[model samples]
Target: MSESGGTFDLVILGAGSGGYAAAIRASELGKSVALIEKDKLGGTCLHYGCIPTKALLHAGEVADNARESETFGVQASLQGIDMQGVHKYKDKVVGGLHRGLTGLLKSHGITIVEGEGRLTGTDEVTVNGAVYKGANILLATGSKSRTLPGLELDGEKIISSYEALRLDRVPESVIVLGGGVIGVEFASVWRSFGAEVTIVEALPHLVPVEEESSSKLLERAFRKRGIKYELGTPYESVKTTDSGVSLTLKGGKTVEAELLLVAVGRGPVSEGLGFEEAGIRMERGFVQVDENLHTGVGNIYAVGDLIPTLQLAHVGFAEGIFVAEHIAGLNPVNIDYDGVPRVTYSEPEVASVGITSKIAAERGIETTEFVYNLGGNGKSQILQTQGAVKVIAAKDGPVLGVHMVGSRVGELITESQLIYNWEALPSEVAQLIHPHPTQSEALGEAHMALAGKPLHVHD
Candidate 1:
């Protein structure tokens, strides 16, 4: 192979959400950028993670709607799931987004390099014997599915979310290991798709990182939906059975299923990538960076799942933009991770932003919280969904957090993010009228109750 050399203002490794976002922002700021990826662009999110999973979730939602159409007074009959057709629909969405991203990158004049890249120096990366030099190098290698030491994924009966996504047929029964976002999401989808689903989590509650109240609510919803869970139990071992697989929990409880999905979590893809060789500090495979995302070695920086932060795609996007603007000498403000909105797209979606009550207490801040049942919301009643909006605010101070569980509550999180980031007071949010007969009204009503004016709610 002929060797080539090119220099750019920024050379980004791993053209996922973070790398691409940085490239676009840097290019927009009049800087040359080279985005390198070994696999397809848009990375895991578009290929196997967020995009495709959400498509499956949406399809599952449709199946659920059809099954429960009698409640809505609609004459739709419940039908079997078509896994082939679901894959086609999921692929179509991913394909369209990938095309748009490629076009956007090209329009910005960003160079797209297709190869596995390694940092040879602080300012240099070598890919396919071609050396690309940059004034700044960003590591955005993203993450991969993580599994336990003894539990090996054979990609068949024992599998991860990646393999689970590509399954041609829904299993008769599935045991999901890990009740965090990924695990719960897959459980929801499989349950809606007519599978007997069970979730195993070592934590005391599902979505353990979320507020305890939110976790309890989600657990209740899951229980009501016939989803089984073994909470606060650790995994011991697994063995492939004649039918599928059998999982042994901490207490010697055995659970059998046609498939055992190890949705444990994702680990950073930083090994054997020359990150440490270039003097970047790493702990447990995650690159350590300062608040500004600088690697403290040279002009090198790291973002996304490579860094020890919230491993969300949107977080990666924001971090990428921040790094680009920082490199451009714009002095961008540091990201307040707590203000970031988080959504779990399950049957009854969970969305939140800012600090929970537990977080406030940990920080020694006194707080008061209010919960507005969606049962009182007209739109929620119309949609036949049951959940609530929870608002947490400082004692006589600003709104500190907002959490919700209901259908399509993810759509309302942007406003909650603004409330949390701007530190809006309960009264301030109460004064602003949310549209009548909408799910958003739940938030407004919660704030109103907290602000000492209960509307359509018993004080």
Candidate 2:
């Protein structure tokens, strides 16, 4: 490879959420950056992951509202969904965001390289036989959806989340393998789209990473939606029948569906990128990074899904900014991964920040919890949504966790994370008033109860 592309101040390996962010921010701080990517600029989150999945979820919401319009005093009939139109809308949204991102990178004066990148040296990356060197290198290679060892993704009967997004019509029935965030989100969409969805999880509950209370509420909601789920049962095998698919469980139980979606999770894309060959330390397929995102190789750093802190796009953005500032000698604060907000955008969305009750107990922190039912909130009754706000505080200390399960509760998690990260006591949070009749008031009410001044809460 010819070392022709001259040294830059910083070279970014992927233009996903983290890499693009670092490129733009480092450029703002007076560092010339080279942003290299194999596919689209916005990467999976914009093209296939967050943006598109959320659009499908929104389409599901629209369908649900139409089906249940009679309760709102509107006698409207729900017609069938046109998957073509849904895909059109999703693609349009993704394209607009991609264009905007491209424009931003151009305006920031960052060089965008279009090809596959590999680290040949500590401060160098080679793309299509062309070598680009930088005084410092940042790797943000991102991740890809993972599949089971024996399950082969044929992209038709057996599919990943990427293929599920491009289906032309809703399946009559779907067997979703995995009860985590990705599986549940797709299950919610398929159910709302009028499909008979069955979720299978090896875990004891759906969304098992969330608070136990939240998981129970979600299971109830899913049951009410007529979405069947088999928990604590491991998958045995799957075979494509003439029409759809036949999935077998450990107990010889069989499920027939038009499709099977594999949503186990995502794995870092670090295999063939030459990180190990270049002597960068890696653990369990993820690059090992310090608190400052350093890769322990000469001025090289890794961020985003490449480093296993959190696989969220927002987390990637924060890591990117942190790396950029740290490289620029600004010495930015390290991200507290525990305090990061997590949201599962399913029906009756689940959102939380900080440790759960289980985690707190595991850490030997005694806690006092208060649950505020949304049924008392005027807005919740008006919207006909059933859920609650839960505040988990220390026995006499600050709030450690805030977990919510309800419609639009994801929006309130920002405030919840703020309270957790700030180490605000229940009394401190109770001093402020949440607007009356709003869903957020449930949060305020929970805090009030935690502070020993219960309002609209039963003893």
lDDT of each: 0.93, 0.93
**Alpha-carbon TM-score of each model against the true structure:** 0.99, 0.98
Local error of candidate 1 at 224, Å?
A: 1.0
Poorly placed runs, candidate 1 (over 4 Å): 1-3
Provide C-alpha RMSD values for all models, in order: 1.2, 1.5
Q: Which 10-residue span in candidate 1 carries the lowest summed lDDT? A: 1-10
Best by TM-score: 1
lDDT (10s digit) by residue, model 2, range 162-211: 99999999999999999999999999999999999999999999999999
Error of 1 at 27 (Å): 0.4
Model 2 weakest lDDT span, ten residues long:
1-10
Candidate 1 lDDT, 162-261, residue by residue in tens:
8999999989999999999999999999999999999999989999988888899999999999999999999999999899999999889999999999
